[model samples]
Target: MKQVKIAGQVVPAIGIGTWHMGDRPAQRETEIAAIQAGISAGARVIDTAEMYGSGRAETLVGAALQPFSRQQLFLISKVLPENASRQRMEASLDASLQRLQTDYLDLYLYHWRGDVPLAETVAELQRLQTTGKIRAWGVSNFDVADLRELWQLPGGDQAAANEDLYHLGSRGLDYAVLPWQAEHDLPLIAYSPIAQGDAWGQQLTTNDTVKQIALTHQATVYQVLLAWVIRQPQVLAIPQTSSVAHMEQNLAAGDLILSPKELAALDQQYPRPTHKERLDII
Candidate 1:
């Protein structure tokens, strides 16, 4: 299986993403089952956020994790940008931990940049690490400039990872953000890694090259997309799904490797940005 290092621990590159999960009471048990199935399939990272359905996702994750050992999982949750301050950050993390039924998070992320000063948020996150409430802290939806500005802060360089929207169809990070991150030894947590469509409404699954590659590997287009996302070192892909079969398939993608020829073909079809492009966020 492909692996990525984060917070000094190695874990599977493919992880479970809980975005709109746990919002429907009707799908609660199956949602929990899907999570557990993913874990059983050897996915160690569970990415959730306090802001996801106002903590509903974290609650579901907590229940699903009851059957597993805590040390076997790497739990990540995000704090709202509004609460990323000295006064409320700790409280927000506490609530997140409560919902997750854990004493500490493997990683805590600032969901996005907000009105709070970056330095203040970084300092609070650094302080929270000492408090044992969080092991490491990072940012999401950050571009190259944002990362450079963050590294200028006192504790910003200590950020273990950054989560962003990345897929074969969205290669803007290829222009600058990826190089900067690779140089800094920072891992990227790619959300929406198997995106269905580009901004122009072009579907990747319909592309001739993508379809041919899927046939070549006898893998689904989604798996091909995921394989492309984690092709680079220090990158992880978290594709959200509510079905047990799909979760299993997503996890299985970690073992799929694309040839240089296949990769180049996909790149040609979805071509990397020639110039700096605005960071894409969901």
Candidate 2:
């Protein structure tokens, strides 16, 4: 239950991701249990998006969070790129709020860059903040250049965070995007920290390096991967889980500290960025 203060709000270092939460009817009960268990275990941040399961994820989150105190939870949701225009963004926000059964979101993000003008979208997001529909706002899947352009706008200074695919294998953001956000004091929400269960195929969890580290700590390969992502103070890793057991394991990873040598070993396996590279998105 480690906490990180980002964009003037305090949140858990490891949040619960609801990417494919409500997609399958058979898994609904387990999904709900996982979310509730995470919250009860002191995971305050929960992230979801309208595009996830076509909004069914948000609905499930709403139902699962009914008994919790809204003020204590850091709820986040994203608007699709196509719906980022001013009018559509507003409509989408309302729909998301209804589905979440909440009056305001702790953080609202633009899913990705779209055809909509950045200035207009920033203005609308600021307006939403003014009206108390959202507390803070940010972007997702934005690289350094996109972030630079975003900051050029009038209300862009209010940008809170940027989220993208960040994991042991995908370290592109370690080059420029991460440093830029750190300089601005904006947190980077790392989605797919385990590569959406592709970590096994990518050798993230099965490789000798990871295996050795896990053995040293008596931890699972998954915990080692989760630990690597959130080892930084300013980064937040949201790894989705449907089992309460896995949810507890994810929360415990917040305390899994990696030594400099172990980190170096990982770097050798998945080299950190040397020069500017396009951000990775999932």
Candidate 2 similarity to native, TM-score: 0.97
**Model 2 agreement with the true structure over 1-282: per-residue lDDT tens digits:** 556886687878999999988999999888999999999988999999999999999999999999999998999999998898877888999999999999999999999988998898888899999989999999999998888899899989789889989999888999998888889887889999988777447867778999999999998888999999988878899999999999998998888898999999999999988988777766
Each candidate's number of clashing pairs is 0, 0
Q: Which ten residues in a row have the lowest lDDT in candidate 2?
A: 197-206
lDDT of every model, 2 decimals: 0.93, 0.90
Model 1 poorest 10 in a row by lDDT: 194-203
Candidate 2: stretches off by over 4 Å: none
TM-score of predicted structure 1? 0.98
Candidate 1 off by > 4 Å? 196-200
- True-vs-predicted CA distance for residue 188, candidate 2, Å: 0.3
Candidate 1 residue pairs in clash (backbone atoms < 3 Å): none
Clashing pairs in 2: none
